[model samples]
Target: MIHAATVQACLAFALLACVSVAYGKPTGQASGRNPSKAALDADQQFDKGSGIAIHKLDGAQIENLLTLGKVWGFLKYYDPTVTSGQRQWDYELFRVLPAILEAPDRASANAVLVRWIDGLGPVPRCSPCAQLDRHDLQLHPDLGWIADTRLLGKTLSRKLQRIHGQRRVGTQFYVALAPGVGYPVFKHEPSYDDIHFPDAGFQLLALFRYWNIIEYWYPDRDVIGEDWDKVLAAFIPRLALARDSATYQLQMMALIAEIHDTHANLRSSLDVRPPVGHCHLPVRLRFVQHQAVVTGIDGTPPNTSMLEVGDVIAKLDGRPPPALAREWAPYYAGSNEAVRLRDIATYMTRGPCDEVPLTVRRGDHELRLKVSRVPLPKDYLAMGDYLAIAFHDLPGPAFRLLSPEVAYLKLSAAKASKATEYIKQAAATKGLIIDARNYPSEFMVFALGSLLVDRPTLFARFTVGDLSNPGAFRWAPPLMLEPKAPHYHGRVVILVDEVTQSRAEYTAMAFRAVPGALVVGSTTAGADGSASRVTLPGGLFTIISGVGVFYPDRRPTQRVGIVPDVVVEPTMAAIRDGRDPVLEEALRLILGPTLPISSIEGMYRSQSP
Candidate 1:
């Protein structure tokens, strides 16, 4: 016969015994010290005593944790019930990593994950949350651990339901609880090079880290032209097979290229093969009217007379221009076909030898020529001598009046502080030509844009991710530039080409928004966004477009550059004759009859001598 008092006393003793074992102290002394501090100290002691190294893991173990980590990061952001409006959620991956790495099999690894989730208290519920739509959801159905009800417990399923519900009903995939709070966003600055890959464990860590960052935060996933989930599935085996440092670096480059972004490229320390570090053919090629034409040749004595201006390159070693471009497309990072071909033309000339065989078409004659490849000059000018001849005679001032009714501002040399002064000077002019053929010296989007408008105009918008809500993107408020007093209501002409990228493209967009502003010249590089640098295993560094930029109506500007109102590409004759065709067109639109054809011809002829 058991008595109630005896049973109660026995239960109390058992509870005290459990507390002593867990806390490493007796019941009386456990209350004297801070409970949290004691618990932390005990955890550290246990970790130190354990034979397992938390930072290291085998190939199998790495793959498992990578799978679990992806799911863990996703739920932390997308599941509103899990976050409960908290600005920051504790990831604590290192705390449980040892146990996870030590697990012998998939079942055992899952057990470790279950224990980690249980430690995080009950998940709150939101009754009004909507269900998830198919298009908005991505699930790893192959991973049974994620779907196992017993492992997740009842609370996790309910929390997942709330996340799905919100996505379905409100079309909200993720929401930023606060600005700059959420996932660890990688910075795009170059801080380190030669990241030595010490071991396989460290290499795998880099792979997992990079994969998760792109999976959750990449804003242009939909425009990437491939199923991102499938890419993750395919790269698993490939990354795991990287056996050496060089191979690992190459693998990282291959993976970065999967994003299809021009900004994605290994840092300069790791030489990108096939596209760099080779002797050039000493000729500049441009895609003109869908044909590859030699626009200029190197004036070096060894390369002189081998190739001439206006020669059409029909074949390289035996392959057509288009086929050759396709062969090099994987190695040449670019956002669009135009930009890709532009870069490929430069790379096609590179080789180990100082000469390459080519089939060229010169008027009616088709002849085989061996073009000498010379080392690029140290003070190489991108514009070459022919184009430089046209600008040589222009006034040395960065901003000057082409005529009384027309003003020209060279964006590459113009100062931002002088933007207002330039605008004031050009206010009465009939036309303003803003030359952006080269990279801008400084950002002048707002400074120059404000002077061209009469009222506040929305020029651009951006898409940013919610840290707590992975894969959820929402448009930030439109960026508007208010007009400064004495706004120039004159026609604006902006010039652009391959060199006009990033800030230059952004500047063009800003100026293009001005009433009657016309963008001239050829297509731009089409890559425009804030670059974010990502460091991978083995000291490999690369970059990606961190944010999505779009027009006011949500038209994408990533792979597609800002279109020009009047397309005026320079011809081979124009380059040889030292004439500025694009500039001539801009003047035609502005000065019309005031500048006669004979006057323009004489102006170009005078620069010849």
Candidate 2:
């Protein structure tokens, strides 16, 4: 998953603050062995590193390690001893990794792995082992690697195959599901935060742990946009040979980004990864038609002399936006290119410098200027307020009557208790616009969506991981929204953009199921499921989309996002004119183009907050 790239100057870091957003009892608890001496030793030595060091790996060594990682991960989930929590898998990896690395050939390495599996004690034959029926499965356990005799050799391959046939089922120590929500929950993964720069063995453990989590536990792994097999092999060397703390963290960031899930990110210090700086330009930037366009400024009465709205930024600190985006893309975790660029734009103006030079295209002429930067407060409390004041532009009441015929509802501040009241008010209007461009204060999927439907309507279906089967996935029942009174008979428009993510995207899906409800805007942040925490070595944490979200008909929404029925993106001309093009388009569809754009421009400015 790691790609070597040439570093560009001032191509510093942007903190990827992805939201850290969480499952059961096993039936076969009586059959498994007690915790082993090795596990106890690992628990006692919790604060120490693996003490393994490797400066580099040749091609053959890399291949052997790749196979070892697969087998080790397979055992971690599949073998009764490891899955029963009797073996400390992380430390077990540490114990075996040095031997695997030193083995001169694949046969010798496989022998080391075989002996390692044998040491776990004989896997008691499961009386009734779990079987793959494939009747209602959305995904089957990807265990083809276990059957590759040529790669794994006859002995190791057969050993893994036998274990697969008797794989542990139910009541796993490593993973489980939430009681009500079916999303996967990882258990007992140590953060190892004490080790600032984990040694070679711990570093490899981190990669193997995360990769296997996605390989087995992630429901959306099928759509990660790459051969997941290749990713493991590619990153083995990168992580095993990580020389320092920054290098280890940056490589982990790149590894997480490969999933292309906006929910996936380095939950720890993201400042270590490049375009590294805290200072940001006074104006907010958004990519319009693939070009960085100035959309809004920070101040109440913003300064427009230096950088006006709709000005296209051709250069930032002498580097073009596209080139800069390329350099920073690997570190920016996103579901799709739209969402990726959306986050990249958020920190495009950020760097270590106090003044950022820019070349702006104003009208037909290029104007070169230097804009002063504001350093965000290091304190999270003040940073939240600063970011709100600077980057966030949604400021108004949760629900408001925009005009005699139209009503506006901003979910950013919406309360569930007022859902009926808002619907009652909007009942008299000809159209209602539900602004989902920002994260909702409350989960309004049923509270708000039910008010727009006439009957119980199926909106979404989820694919959840099976603990017994690990990598296997099966469809849960489709979620439906029951009809509620005061149902607004008026047309509905749900506004969304890249900022719309997770619960926001899920809410849009529910609202879009209404008879005449229309989604208007560009693509949204495609990460739609609840995020599960994956603790790694070096005291690091990352997340993955724990479940698969799809439409009633089984259409995917993980990375594709909620598709808009009427796509409307802000143009340079429209943005400079102080207009909301997406909202205007919704009004046109509802008001039949009778009202002028100027009349719809500031409708929310006078609304109650």
State residue 472's C-alpha deviation in candidate 2, in Å.
0.4
Model 1 lDDT per residue over 53-139, tens place: 333346667555655556555554555534343221222445565676678866677667666666665444545554323342322
Estimated TM-score per prediction?
Answer: 0.69, 0.91
Residue-wise C-alpha lDDT for candidate 2, range 1-609, written one tens digit per residue: 111011000001100112322101111121122233456445654346788889889998999999988898899888998888887777788888889889999999999999999998987889778877677699888888789988989999999999888875574877878544567767767666667564888788888999899999999988999999899999998998888988988999999999999877775645665677777777778888889998877766648437888899999999999999999899878889988888778777777657778899999999999888777445422221112322222466787788888988888789988999998888789999988898776767767777888988888888888888889999877777778787789999999888888877888988999998899998888988666767777666666777798999999999999999989876888777766788878878888878766677656445525
Candidate number achieving the greatest lDDT relative to the actual structure: 2
Alpha-carbon RMSD to native, per candidate? 15.7, 7.9
What lDDT does the true structure give each of the candidates?
0.58, 0.77
